[model samples]
Target: MPDRPRHYLRQQLRWMRGTTVRHLWWLRHMPLRSLGFWMPVVEYPHLVLALLVPVAVLATP
Candidate 1:
């Protein structure tokens, strides 16, 4: 476990928190069905990308 990955993950989580809050606020005006569609389209990729940070660090020397 290196400082770089920890820093990167922290930064990404901070960004994700802000974006998630903003998106939740925006979603309030939309219909419930839209959540099902948007969750995968927007949220899942962010999650996957965040998860990949660790895998990428592991893959490196």
Candidate 2:
């Protein structure tokens, strides 16, 4: 392959890698942006705690 095309391809790959890094960085700290559905469930602690007791009892040794 020619040098210019190979260099361009490498640059494009680098740009893609940079974009992927930025996306992952955002995901690591900005959890709500990715998990909108899960946020509501987390807000209701009492209901969750009530349900967990039965499930835990069922699974106990």
Candidate 3:
């Protein structure tokens, strides 16, 4: 676990970036019938929500 909020956010960003890159690569290289082609549907929405939660929390006054 991260020792601070900044570290946690940085880790989440890294995970999000890696997941996005992996999805892009899968879209380019994987067949439509493969699990890789379908993984983003399972994973991407959660990542977007993870991203949004932090932003929402920070945006609140």
Candidate 4:
């Protein structure tokens, strides 16, 4: 595995962690039902994009 992509991914995850904490703090201010749909929408894409971008780039021949 290339170190660069993995390193980049780690950075992304770190950013996502901070973003998630901040976002969840805001989410707590919203209604419960709003959280059910919105949390996954905001969170999953960050995690997936963080993983997907590095893999797709690293996987390139």
Candidate 5:
């Protein structure tokens, strides 16, 4: 019973590590210029929403 939790934790960590590595590799290979333009929206999503809300309200009929 004690070993079961340890085994489960190891398996979970392996999965998380693999997922993180895969995502990092993908990001590393992606085009940096396009990513740069969108990075701010990802980093400060509230800013994007603040800018969009007014445009959305004005465009509505």
Candidate 6:
């Protein structure tokens, strides 16, 4: 696990990028029941939420 917020986000982004690329072909060609097809469907939004943490933090007074 990452010790700092920056490190965590970096790790998450790396994971998101790597996963997307690794599964790109499968995501494009695999059926709905396939792991690759479902992975991004769940993961992208989760990653985007992770990316919004800083904004959420900064928005608080």
Question: Which candidate leads in TM-score?
Answer: 3
Off by over 4 Å in 4: 1-3, 29-61
All candidates: TM-score: 0.43, 0.45, 0.64, 0.41, 0.45, 0.54
Tens-digit lDDT track of model 1 for 1-61: 3369888899889998997777766676666677644674587688888999999999999
**Highest lDDT model number:** 3
lDDT to native, each model: 0.77, 0.69, 0.90, 0.78, 0.70, 0.86
Q: 1-61 in candidate 3: lDDT tens per residue?
A: 9999999999999998997898899989989999988888668788789999999999999
Model 4 residue 38 CA deviation in Å: 8.7
Whose TM-score is higher: candidate 2's or candidate 3's? 3
Q: Which of 2 and 4 is the better model by lDDT?
A: 4
State the lDDT of candidate 6 residue by residue for 7-61, as single tens digits.
9999999997887687777778889987768987887789889999989999999
Candidate 2 at 41: error in angstroms?
A: 20
Displacement of the residue 15 alpha carbon in candidate 6, Å: 7.8
Q: Residue-wise lDDT of candidate 2 within 13-33, one digit each (tens)?
A: 999789657656655666675
Candidate 4: tens digits of C-alpha lDDT, residues 1-61? 3369888898889998997787777666766678654875677788889999999999998
Query: How much does candidate 3 score in TM-score?
Result: 0.64
Please list the Cα RMSD from the true structure of every candidate, rounded to 1 decimal place: 7.6, 14.4, 5.2, 7.8, 10.8, 5.1
Candidate 5 residue-wise lDDT at 7? 88
Candidate 5, clashing residue pairs? none
- Candidate 4 displacement at residue 28 in angstroms: 2.0
Superposed model 6: Cα runs more than 4 Å off: 1-18
The better candidate by TM-score, 2 or 4, is 2
Residue 30 of model 3 has an lDDT of 89
Candidate 4 — which pairs collide?
none
